[model samples]
Target: MGVFIHWAGTAALLAQLAGAAVAWGADGGADGVVAVGVEEFLGSTGDSAEQLLRLDLDRSGTLRAREDGVGGGWRLRGSSSAGRIDGALLDAQGAMVFNNHYADADLRDNVHAFADDVVTAITQGRGLAASKLAFVGSREGRRQIYVADSDGERIQQVTSDAALKGSPSLGPGGVLMAYTSWQSGFGDVVLKDLRDGRERTILSAPGTNSGAAFSLDGTRLALTMSYQGNAEIYMASVSGSRVRRLTHARSVEFSPAWGPEGNRVVFCSDAGGGPQLYVVGRQGGAAERVETGYRHNTSPEWSADGVHLAFTGRQGGGPAVVVHDLASGQNRVLLARGEEPTWAPDGRHVAAVLDGALVVVDSVTGRRRTIVRGFSEIREPSWSR
Candidate 1:
């Protein structure tokens, strides 16, 4: 285990003192770690109904539920053949907490929402069971944006641009995705509303416009554009107005990731003679280099807790997933042979491209498991919040 410290100046110091810093340690068994063992919690339900959620689904799309970790079986909560339950919540005695209905084709997604509520109630943590992932998959002879469950099930293509697409980032609520596409013969930033099938070209200047990343509030986006004759970092409202340049460097900048508090942005730039990590104010100012001692680093992503950042870095050979602890000022490899690291809502597991497929790995336990594959290639995975 190796630790590297680089003070990010007064702003970073203030943020750390405000309780936004994340402490990093070599011990993988920390008590603060969130363990998302769906098989353990769901498959090994205890006799208590106080902190568990029971679910039952059949081939007919009928669903039932229970609360409090009861193992007796599911209650006749609802049914859906052509429609689906919009939302659901249950209390300890298998009683209704909340429920809604939806007449849409995305029945599974609706169920996921309800499950998320149940998990939150039980663990008081983000529901990894219900979170989603957005990535670029070349399944149809062209790279396009695809969405799937965090487990990589229920995969569906969200774009058919018949061109290249990459860098998919989920918005604040996981309700939208911003990505880059080459449908216009030049790189363009596009937004897709996940709730409804609506698409909007957010940035399409004469030059390259790519690497779209959404702030924690979903109100602003940080991306890379070359419209000013050089690749620079820019921030803009989701509506495409109030565009502000954040980095005015001569060296090219790309892959801007919004910090957890939405006040800072970390990105990749060659201003340090090699592609390296840099952090700057979201409003734009001097860029501070992240002294990782690596030859290259890119694809920066902030953990949900804002305590750590994950990016691609390697001294040689292929890039690997690296996590930098904001609190401890330490960085370490999470995955030995993966890149494009994106954090699960719990911030314990990371989704990355490994061997031409998408895999989720527990950074603490060092457990690596494949989520999905079979496409010609899958890269740039963005786990939903």
Candidate 2:
């Protein structure tokens, strides 16, 4: 059997046989490698739940699931009964770390909760299992807004506008969604409440209004509008009132994304003769170029920790997903053939469109898997925090 070793901090963890082990923090200052073992669950939905939890844990990249015969550092056992799932996490010495009963209405919901709980207990970091994604999907030659779980399950169409829709952005907690719709013969920003199914035109400017993004706090939005004759970034309240202009570049500015602190916004501009990334204050000021070393970049999405900025950059005559470090002032390509990158809640993974399919990519290891596909076309994905 081959052995794999991974180094973290000052220690190296070994993965034995065919199973991989990852190092994570434990309670009481104990830090070591962890390999989780799963036992077959019993009940009506037990089999499906077990499979899903294992898949999610592996996809997290923070831990691994042990094979049937391989020994593990922790054991996960669960059961489903009467529309509820009971799950428990135990250490090697049989110490209980987590034991909870999830009463979600759907099996996928319960599985997501259990998987997120295990990841949090082991790594002390946020989990992406429960996150949702909003993107533009085409059906019957018409584009519409659609929402689905991070795992590409429970997909539901959010809009029925048969005209054209794009640039779907999900607000905090996935409660509200904003997108650009061409149903009225002009590109306008439409805000929809996912709970009550209420739709309202948030920005119906004369020329065009598109690329709407919600603030980190979900109270404000940053978008592009041409009502004033030239495309410029603008800020507005969530209710589409109190509108304020953020950028006044004569060369055109669009695709505005808010920083995690909400004090600054990054967007794409052609002021320098090519589409480049720039940062401007929320209150409007002189914009500073981000210096990505790329002649063209667009669709900027800030990480949850506010440390990295992911966007689409031109590479090899095609669109590539690139991440720029804010502090180190460095840029690295995450995907060679993807665009319109969005960050997962964990900030370590990104979702982008590759070959007309939505895929989730691990920024560190460069591993990726298709999460949403089979549509006529998919683009502009937005992940919930």
Candidate 3:
């Protein structure tokens, strides 16, 4: 069973400066005091747009299940160019007991089918990282990104470059993150591979580019690009090439999120007046408004089962997390004052930013607990495969 751990520091609010200090370590000086830490002991802002592109996921058949080396399970590494897929199933000796290959496009459909084939043919029945969650955190300071156990433990920061970073979204295996950072002193989108901390510049513009949503198949990405002018939705090949603008207008449109079906995108747009929820097709068409008269409602996230939509907005006392059921047309408030609601892959509960820290709340019971805390500012979180 997973459990929540509370980690707190005696450092008072007046000592908040120490938060950044220990996070940075002034001259590597100052005797180590009780530095503030995340309760989970883990381990955002802004926009920039330029024709400027930086990081990318490499979608042009850059990778597939390897057919040679050691296979059975899809453990293929990412590639930048097309090549024969090679892999194998390893015993204790790391020898190739299983291996094969097909054209990349041929095995693209129903990715899960191949995954299951591997699991059943090899490991009996074990799920891939498909059931994982990943997010960026400042828990260890310096704006480093971290991946943790589903319950937020075993926290590991994948990036330590110390550049301001935020808006991390998980791809197929949850082993990579697409985010915006100031590493170049200019806002740029980059893809960070969690395995080795290697980064690829995907999109870097003058102002800001963020909100990367991986397609259900993990073959494409839907994101908000401000390079042209005001933020608009666009489709980009995962490899960072072939960027196709999907929206064209003067209104502010951003925070593009992929629907469970993978063919639609739900995002927050002021196009509806005061920033309301809107849904558009993956191919980009007339956006349909989902709400009215709420003054403010942003962050539309579809549930795991695609039955409900959870978002944050001020419908009452303060900003709250609201779930909208599509079939029954029911509106349920999961928690008040919640920001960045990321549904667990299983949809059993949602990990939300509550009271300025990462918290998980029961969708039905409304009970909540702080899983990550003690940071100067915490916001804009995403879930992984």
Best candidate according to TM-score: 2
lDDT of 3 at 95: 42
lDDT of 1 by residue, 221-301 (tens): 999998889999999888775589999988989999888788999999998777999999977889888777789888989
- CA shift of 355, model 2, Å: 1.4
Off by over 4 Å in 3: 1-130, 139-141
Error of 2 at 371 (Å): 1.8
Clashing pairs in 1: 22-327, 49-68, 49-69, 50-68
Q: lDDT per prediction?
A: 0.70, 0.85, 0.60
Worst 10-residue lDDT window for candidate 2 reads 20-29
What's the distance in Å from true for residue 303, model 1? 0.4
Q: How well is each residue in 193-226 modelled by candidate 2, as lDDT tens digits?
A: 9989998998898898999899989999999988
**Candidate 2 segments whose C-alpha is farther than 4 A from its true place:** 1-33, 69-72, 91-93
Q: After superposition, how far is residue 254 of candidate 3 from its true place, in Å?
A: 0.9
